[model samples]
Target: MRAITFVPGKQGTLGITDVPEPEPGAGDLLVQGLALGICGTDRELISGEYGWPREDPMILGHESLGRVLQVPEGSAYSPGDLVVGVVRRPDPEPCGACARGEFDMCRNGEYTERGIKERDGYGSERWTVEAAYAVKLDPGLGTLGVLVEPASVVAKAWEHIERIGSRAWFEPRTVLVTGAGPIGLLAALLAHQRGLEVHVLDRAADGLKPALVADLGATYHAASDLKAVGFKPDIILECTGAGPLVFDAMLNTAAAGIVCLAGVSSGGRLLSADAGQINRDIVLENDVVFGTVNANLRHYRAAADALSQADAAWLERLITRRLPLDRAPEAFDRGQDVKVVIELGE
Candidate 1:
């Protein structure tokens, strides 16, 4: 079997390597890898900017889609079932959150993620996952199921946003999503589903991004500044981790607003800001600014449902490139496309 392998913290080590076939354990499902999604995280890992160090090469994909080749009898899954493997697993000493199947909120910071942390991932011709950590998807999704992992992230964000909004008679009318990337676009999709007026801001002046936003019945802004958005949004889903944009989102929301920071910003870039003014804005307006990452099984299920209900053609357009497994490395190159997928098998 062949798998994408790389050493953590070592640049230029990503490559395709032959590895032994995976064997299923009790209650484990043996799945044939179908596809893998490439994102900023994968790029960082390949560049040695992120990921935990390991002496041996580790499998390098987390956004995974596979079809069951074998499964334990009496299990909820069966052969030919389409599935996605959940990324984060509970810490050895289960925390309060992890004990409740909410490892996404693991308080100890000791949780292990499939590709980014201490565990091997699903970027192989064959992979084995404990049935408990596998999420079944609609067979109709096909290779599009590769998106479930990233979508799970935004699903968690939306879940948290609505929870915070419920503190009062919250009927949010408008939402501003910064960055028109997959996360931002999906955030806009969920917002539009809720009947909110959605506005997406991206630096792309004219491209598929703006068109995609328009197709969703949302407004798109081709500017770098939040002030150009024209109206104060009731909710801000900040998908661009740019420091300036993060601060701008905090200051540019309506009273009793919620700002969800979903992007991971690289460090070392400093910015000047007025702490007093930013604090005053939040305090006076009863605003809530929170950051969210990762997702539990519940969010994955929610994401699958969201994708299943979405326009199939629109979802298909999100995936702009697909390369075969042998050419997996090319998928990591920075591109303007919304999603890049590595096809592992038919």
Candidate 2:
């Protein structure tokens, strides 16, 4: 089978190569790979900036969509079902969080993730996943189901946001989503689904991004400064790891507001921030700033539900480009696209 492989920490090692076909163990599902979504994490892995160091090249895709080719008897899924494999698996020690099926919040940082960490990912012509970790999607989703994985991340973020907001009388009416990328757009989608007034901020002054946000019945601001957003947002989903923008979001939210940090920032850059004022604002306003990454089964399921209920046309627009497996490496090139997907099947 042809698969996208990369040697972790080795720059210029990403390519298409032949690998043994996946063999499913008991209680596993053999799936025919359909599509693979490319994100910043994939680019980091290809650039040798992130991922566990391994001598041999490992398959390199986590955002996956496929149709089940075979399933164990009595499995909840069946052959021909559309499914997406969960990325993170429980750690060996199974930390308190992982033991509770919250490996996304692995306390010891020992958890293994498919297509990441020490395990082989699903960026192949075919793949196998334990039935428990395979999320069955609506057949109607087709290739768009590749979005479940990223959506799951924001689902977990919203889940945590609500949990924190529950401490007070939380009826948030306005939300500001920083960055108009996949995560930010999906974050806005989920917020819109909840009936919140959504506003998205990005650097692009004119592009499909601003148009997409407008189609959602939400407002879009194409400005680097958050001050242009005008009113203080009741909730802020900061999807751009830009240092200055992150701090701007912290101080720009309404009183008792919650800010969800869902973007991973590349280090080595320093900024002079007013720590005292930032701390004072949070303490005085009782605001919360939290970071979330990855997703467990619960979030994946929530993501599937959200995708299923979303406007199909809108969801389709998120995928701006699709390439064949042989051209998978090209998908990593940064472009003015919301999502880039690699088609694994002919």
Candidate 3:
């Protein structure tokens, strides 16, 4: 089998490599890879900035869609089912949260994240996962199903937003998503589907990002003048790791607002900020700002439903390019496309 892999902490080490095909164990599903979605995290991993691979030649993918080739007896899924493998696995010594199957909220820093930490990922022709971690997808999704893992991140963020917003008398009607990347765009999709007034902020004004935002019937801002959007947004989902925008999103949200930071920032870029005023705003307005990453099984299921309900044509536009396994490295290039996918197998 051919797989995209990288040696963690080594710059310029990512590429394709031959690896043995995995066999399904009892209670496992052997899935033939169909597509893999690329993102900033993959770039960071290739540049030796974000991942913690336990060994050399670690398979480099987490966002994936596959079709089952084999399934264990008594499983809910059958062979030929389209599925997505969940990325995080609990630690050997499970933390309180992991013990409750909330590995996404692991208190201990010992969890293994597929493609990002410790374990091998799904960037291969085939891989095997425990049946419990495989999420079934709608067959109608086809290549569009590749977006589900990233969509799950959006799903979990909204789940937490609604959960935290319930702390007060909350009825949010407007949302601002900072960054028009896959995560941010998907976040906008969910917000629009919920009938909230959605506004997307990105640096691009006339390219694919803005067009996709418009296709969603949501507002697009170049992020040059966020204040020009008129009123403060009731909810803000920050998917850009740029330091200034992170703080700006927090400072500009509405009263009683909830801000979700879903982007991981690479440090060393400095920006002057008024921590005192930020504190004052949160304190006075009872605002909530939280960071979310990865996802649980429930989030994957929610993401599948969200993708199914989305306008198929609108969802298709978000996919900018699709390449094969040998050209997997190309997916990492930061092009104008909203999403890049590696089509691995039939």
Against the hidden reference, what TM-scores do the models get?
Answer: 0.99, 0.99, 0.97
Q: What's the distance in Å from true for residue 29, model 3?
A: 0.2
Please give the CA lDDT of all the candidate structures: 0.94, 0.94, 0.90
Candidate 3's TM-score: 0.97
Q: Which ten residues in a row have the lowest lDDT in candidate 3?
A: 48-57
The digit string of per-residue lDDT tens for model 1 on 1-346 reads 9999999999999999999998899999999999999899999998999988877999989999999999998999989999999999999999999999999999999899998898999899889999999999988887789989999999999999999999999999999999999999989988888889999999999989999999999999999989789989999999999999999999999999999999999999889999999999999999999999999999999999999888888988999999999999999888788999999999
Clashes of each: 0, 1, 0
C-alpha lDDT (0 to 100) for residue 318 of candidate 1: 91
The local distance difference test score of model 1 is 0.94
* Over 4 Å off, model 2: none
Residue range 1-346, candidate 3, lDDT tens digits: 8999899988889889999989788999999999999988889889987766445689989998999998888999998999999999999999999999999999988999888888889999999999999899999988788999999999999999999988878899999998998999999999998999999988886878888899899999985546757779999999987788788877788888999999999888778999999999988988888999999999999999999999999999888898988888888887677888999998
